[model samples]
Target: MNKKTSSFLWNLRQLNLNICPFGSSSIRRMMKGDHLELQKPKITYQNSILKNLLLLQSLQKPLLSVRFFCQGVLVFQLEGSEIQKRRLNTLTSASVGKLLYPRQLSSDSQCFFMSDTTPHLAVDGPKKMMVPLEHDLSQKEKQLDFVKHRHLIKHCNSMSDVLDIFSKFPRFSSCNYFISMWKIAKNMSEDQKRFERQLLYEHPAFNQLCDQVMKEAKTVKLQQVIFTLYALIKIGIPQNTYLVQVLLRVVQERINECDETCLSVLSRTLEAMGKSKNVDALRAGLRLLVDKQIWTLEHILTLQTMMKCIGKDAPYPLKKKIEIKALKELDKFSPVNSQHMFGALAALNHRSVILLNECSKMVAADIHGCPFWMLMSILQSCRDLQYQNLDLFTAIADYVTTTFDMWKMKQVLALLLVFESLRFRHIGLMNLFLKRVVDISQSLNQKEILCILHIYSSLNHICDSENQQFLEAITSALNTYLPKMSSFSLLKAVYCFCVLNHFPQEPFNQLFQENIINELLTSGTESERTEYMLHQVNACLELEGTSVLKSTAITLRECSSAPFRSHVDIEEMLLNLLENKRLFLKNVQLPHNYFVDFELRMDSKRSKVFPVSEADAFIAEPDIIRVALLCVSRSAFCFGTTHPRGGLGIKMRHLKALGFHVILVNTWEIKKLDMSLAVTFLKNKIFSQEAFPTAPGFAA
Candidate 1:
């Protein structure tokens, strides 16, 4: 018996067969027969598996039946996008694969849902994606012919078989033959891929079939055209060919007929040819298709395609639709796909906590097999969304630690950027990264070294005896590239050095020269950001870099724009409560051009709030405590965690540096409490004896 037949029998033996149609040779014949089949082979186990119900509904074929077991159901469809889903719970080795006959998905297909645990189709053909049964007899006869051809196509397992199938039905089965060939090629080992590439690269018949596929692009189904295009690119077919040009014109004419999957295919096809303008056009075309096709993401491939189409700049409403649709199919998402979805959404600067947290669960569970790039993307997303799941980070760190030898410096730098931006620290990962980076310090580029210095400057970058070696290695690398950098970048690098208290001797002369100082103050690129960096650099020098730049006085002008007002519920309520007491000052400008959420001057003895900026000279008294309420939103903290992000840390540090007592007001928490209780919470937090120490300009 074949493995499918054997597994089917073992599954029958594990469950009661009285109610199952498989008591006969039905499932067995379905496994090995020529008729269309969707088989999910079940495993045999020691414990007895339960089967309280086994329902089998026969369709046209004697052996063909839609089967479901109490303990077994389909977790995913095996055939077309229209097939229904059934659950096979606790089935460890579950994969849905099918030998589909040539025919459109019939009206019998259903969208599976459940009232309780047992998976079932509540309704059939809800979206009408299936073919109608009202076609004439000749059409059905044509379908029968297609099915026979598809059966022959299924037996194809090698590149030679692909050639035979293409020659037999070059018009009808060309798409399937291309897909089959790619499947065979992808599963091959390195030697196999090399041999196959040699076997097919210059074959005379391959060129004829390539011309056939390009000709078929005009009248064939748009779906087949796209599939053949993508598959041809994946195979050894030269990308810069007339075939791609012909298909490109055809696709442009039929752009509206393209679905989400086709859009993604066009994206990949154009990407392969380096036809970026066409890819951008396809991205622009998405705005029209999104509304109608957004809800049709039923398969993993479809979802991934939709994700690529959505990309970073899709509108928020469209992104929200993708998020909701993704959430429904979340259980079916593979680990890499899940992280890819997260990365796509996060890149748009849109975040869904439910989605982020769910994907994190999947990533943490599948740590060992997850790719380092996917892990880095998740970290970047988490950092973008201000979500820090330590469990996920720890799992990724362990995974990277195991696979450290395979990582490139660019990927390691990306990890450090995420860690630095998120204000996260991993002692072990850091050590591994430091050692690797130090060993390759000679090969480091200007951008890479600046990234390292910035990370160290934001993190625990105290230059102690133990840290001396790492700091020196980074500084040594920076010294080589500093002279080549622009004035703006050089200024930022020195600011980071001053923050770390690691003054390299080479760049100081170039950084403080009159010409460089003028360029730093007046450079047009990133002017506002450059001004802010200069302001901080001036402060860093006043506190730390005093020995140098004594003769050169850097101008400190406030480029601080008016911060957008937050209308969040907690902040509004807090502002109202304090406004009635005449003590809440909105948008109070602090000493170093830092704008606060609200400033409250209160009596230390009586805990009474008062306004000191007014004519009241009571502000001069030492009994008053100046409190700056930093109303932080939910996004300000790490996603799903309570830790504040790196940006918030900087704001708090700057507030404290200006001698204003900083209080981080978590709006998400206080927004839940009643007004009376919230007042009590605020009072206790503001007046309690506990005090957070004044942090350094760049706290390690």
Candidate 2:
């Protein structure tokens, strides 16, 4: 065979060995025998033959002979006749034979063949054809001989051959050979390039190639250095290795000499290698380029790389210069560069409404092609900058809704989190997202489950249909994934349920068990632990109609002395007293539009004692007391100005007008009251004559 045919056959052999499901042993056995064999030429084997026939046809070679055996009995053969030759030609031309006679070949039958001769057949029919033994052996021999004489370099043409040669003869290989082979490979098809990359690390000379590149580090051309570094990274070399460090030093030394394109390549190479300490050297190089006025869109991309590598540690001046230059070129920014620019700005926490508007316009124009990650980056930047552009968010939501099914779990969670952070919710988008979560619910991790639940609960409105299905799916997933959840995640989950006023029986029981609750409470900061414990207690109270553990209630009451009780903690304490019947009242009103907190009735005797005339309807009924628990900051009331309608003053007026003996208890004051003290305060308000002391002049 000519060199081209030989190379084709060699590649075919390699592909067959790598991809064939039956393994190389089958191919090896076929090559060793004078005739090929298929023990039970099933449809699958027939399909394999038909697929290989395409490769064989490219060789323009003719089949010589064919044989079929059934249980060692020669059931059919085609040979030594023009009619048989015509049959062979016809069979080769007819690609649909396997489909036509898929199961016609007996399970006991075996097909075999020999090349370079005419077919001899006892019967005339099409069947699965095996590879010719001679051709297979000849190809095998050529491969062996090629390996044996690979050091001579004459047998090497493709990148694979070069790799094989280098693998066997690295000590004798020249740097020129390595460079030339990579250059040749660079021009090959993507598949060939991918195959070569896979072979690169397995090649015996991989380490030697790295060593040679390092040894000639200073002498290699800039392109050679770039190509070498690119290849090393593609081959999975460690970025922090001494070899990479030496290579980086070489690149840095020659960086000033590089043109814009070369500098771009160098920057990307450093990025691909994840080198951050080289930021100073790279920044210096970029400054040289900048001074030379060699900047371009590529430089902007490289700037993003630098930002990612250096993070906030990048000097303010360098970042500002890059930002100014990048913004000036905003109109010229592609979708990809725009993404990087936004990401860089977010990394530095830089904010510019003008730049944001420019980015917004660009993103709006190219939102169709914007990838999931790019959308995430834009949203993240919006959040970091606290820039709320509804138009931009709407466009992203539109894209995500259309492509919701294509998203992975992480992407879905990230998109949901960004939406939640921005407080941007779209019903269609949320429904699609929830459906995806349901489909992949079994695969979701604890963190992802918590994030989804958080997003749902955080939204101001979630349609009941989606909410029910979503909660059900999460409840099912919690059964399987709860044990794997971290204590922090579990706590968040409880809080999420409490926020939504949802607590599935099984998950809540598992979640609020004594040990799990105790573990959760002990692991977080004092505030976080207290908040989580309160959520658990509230969820249990809402879903199970009882206190959590007595210990949990006591712990919450003790921790409630933090001098800043949260709204939930305050509610939990009040509910605990009510559930225990420590502070009894015949009539109680839950929170409503007029009453800010709980309303309770005092004893009848106390009511008669504090009675007022019916003309002054503003006076609260002697039997009634309305409680308002205010968690406002001390500053809120300091200036005698409260927030408009939701403020304490407005609430106090509304409650007093509704005939309530309004008692305002600040959270700071309530936090100082234990269970006994809190009950005492309530009882004192109820029965004490001074508690309802006739408003300003009424008799007691």
Candidate 3:
């Protein structure tokens, strides 16, 4: 049984039969022998019971002349002449074992016959009646034919069957036929489209047929199904406008139940549509996907393709509208919701010329933080192009200025650094950026002051003698801000100072006064102390060379009443200064522990070191003779050691004492000088070697 039939039977079994009809097969043969025979099989469950009842009714028709066969049994014995006399064949039997045809049973089954002896005997029986009905079997055949047509379409296995059905109907004439075909096409395997396309590509006739079906057809569902399928074909181009319009109409008509696949199809079709440069189709396709909330992978991918197609082709007004709409839509989804936003950004870049204005507004508003990083990356990436638009630049600059206004020092400094790095691109903007950095540095946050200082450090690299005025202006500004700032800020200031060490001493000495250096020493944490100490040492070493140490001792004499220890102990302070200086030398390769004192006993390792600048001359150059004489003078006055060359222990002192500008010379240049006699005097005649016993404090 069919599923529907079985289900119907299960529902019908609970009801009792009421006025069911029955008929005999011989009467059916007599009725149908002169009429059209029922072609279908009989409905067996009820047919056999109806047939037997008719036969019984016919057999009882001649029982009108009844006689008693037993005490309680009635026997009907009627001859043909008697039956004709009372019309017994025409009368229906009201008793059992009587034959009745369908029409004959209804006419006589209700008639009552009175027997003369039976009236005296008083025979009575229950009432029985039969009603005849007419049946039209053609309605059943029509219903079966409809069902059979549907079943055939459903199980169609070959293309010939589909083509035959298609040929049987006029183009778009039979709605039901087309609807059925649509359902079938929807159920067709995905490969069917590829197959159809292959057919179209390999066979010109099929292509024409598909085009007619897609473009000029009146069948709406069929049109959409064919158009979407054709789009899926990956073959020759079809009419993009028709496909997009149909899909969009279908999506809108079926609102609240739109298929995601339809949205996806519309999206993929955009690539092909874009090749036509059909802006209408592009807009419609985007609107449909947005409407359906189907920002699927295909949708994003298609957007990327659409972006590439329309690169600079976007008109200003339309571009503005698209920007507003896209941002609003993206805001709805939150750009952070997915990484697809990166793709979206990439698309935006293609339309950047027109988008830059709207983008600037969005960025200036700063309501959405997600796109800021993206915008920054875009600016950096696009820097190489000469045509890099200024809308983006002005937007970023305006954003940084606003950040400065809002006291977002960290953000301002970050922007300043980016601008400074990109100064080579827009060279004219360098001064403006520097001025802004100077402004930010005035109120810079402790966390961000180092970054600003780093920007200055980079700026120094860019500044030449031609731009010396600007560099001097910046240096003067740093001098004012350095003392009151925190330790990290001071370290950053010192770093900036070291980077721009070419400045003259008057302004430099003003920077090194008690307040500035003390601020560095007192406010700086351990790490900052170490860092700045290294910065100072490297700068002073490069600037003064060996004479830096002698200047330190002379500076110590100015601090005479502060404290004094044995002159032999002065080396500790000197070592501390040199170690810290060595830490600041940039890119200089030195041995491990070359600057560290492994024997120092302080809990804080820095306590064993000192600022070499404090114990030596801060000079303009290295002079070997001047440094040697000064070293001799310091050893004679301070250490009083019996060495051949007086104070020869001071190696770099004589170099700077003779007014040498060491900045013009490198360390190796000074090293190759002829100092062999001086070296022997210092190593051998400078002192009588004495070895001590191995006790902690009792060496004699």
Compare the candidates by lDDT and give the number of the best one.
Answer: 1
Write candidate 3's Cα lDDT for 1-700 as tens digits.
2653444343223211111124446545654663222222232323332342322322232222222111122222223212111322232223321222222122112222222222222133211111121121233233234433365467554333444554433232222333344345555676884564354345433333444443323223433553444333333334554544443443343433434444444444443444443445444545544534523333333443444333344545544544454554543442232223334444444344333444444543543343446555545544422224444566556544444445344444555566555542223343455555555444544445456446555444343433465455555556565446554445455545445443333334444556555655455367444543444434354544345232431121111121222222223332332333332222221121112111111111112221234224422322111111111222122112222121121222222332321111112222343454324332232112331121112101
TM-score, cand. 3: 0.25
In model 3, how large is the Cα lDDT of residue 201?
43
lDDT by residue for model 1 over 1-700, one digit each (tens)?
Answer: 2654555555454443433325546756655662212232332221111111111211111222223332243332324423345665432211111111111222111222121232244124221212232232234444334434345456766676667655655544355667667767767787876777676655556776766565456556798888877777777566556666566656766778986667677656654554355555655665557656767746766555556555666777877777788888887888777667666666556778888888888888987877667777788778777777778888887777778888777877788688777666666677778887768888888888888878766664443444777778877888887657889779878767765656666776778778887876766788877777677666655544557554444666666675756746655566545555355766777655668877777666434566555515766778777788887787666444555554455566656666678887777788889887886666566655442222112111
lDDT of each: 0.61, 0.55, 0.37
What is the lDDT for 221 in model 2?
62
Candidate 2 — which pairs collide?
77-120, 77-121, 78-119, 78-120, 78-121, 79-119, 79-120, 79-121
User: What global local distance difference test value does model 1 have?
Assistant: 0.61
RMSD of 3: 29.7
Least accurate 10 contiguous residues by lDDT in model 1: 93-102
- Model 2 Cα lDDT, one tens digit per residue, 220-278: 46776766676566545567777666767777767766765665566556556553576
User: Lowest lDDT 10-mer window, candidate 2?
Assistant: 65-74
How many angstroms is residue 406 displaced in model 3 relative to the true structure, after the best TM-score fit?
15
Error of 3 at 494 (Å): 1.2
Model 2 global lDDT (CA atoms, 0 to 1): 0.55
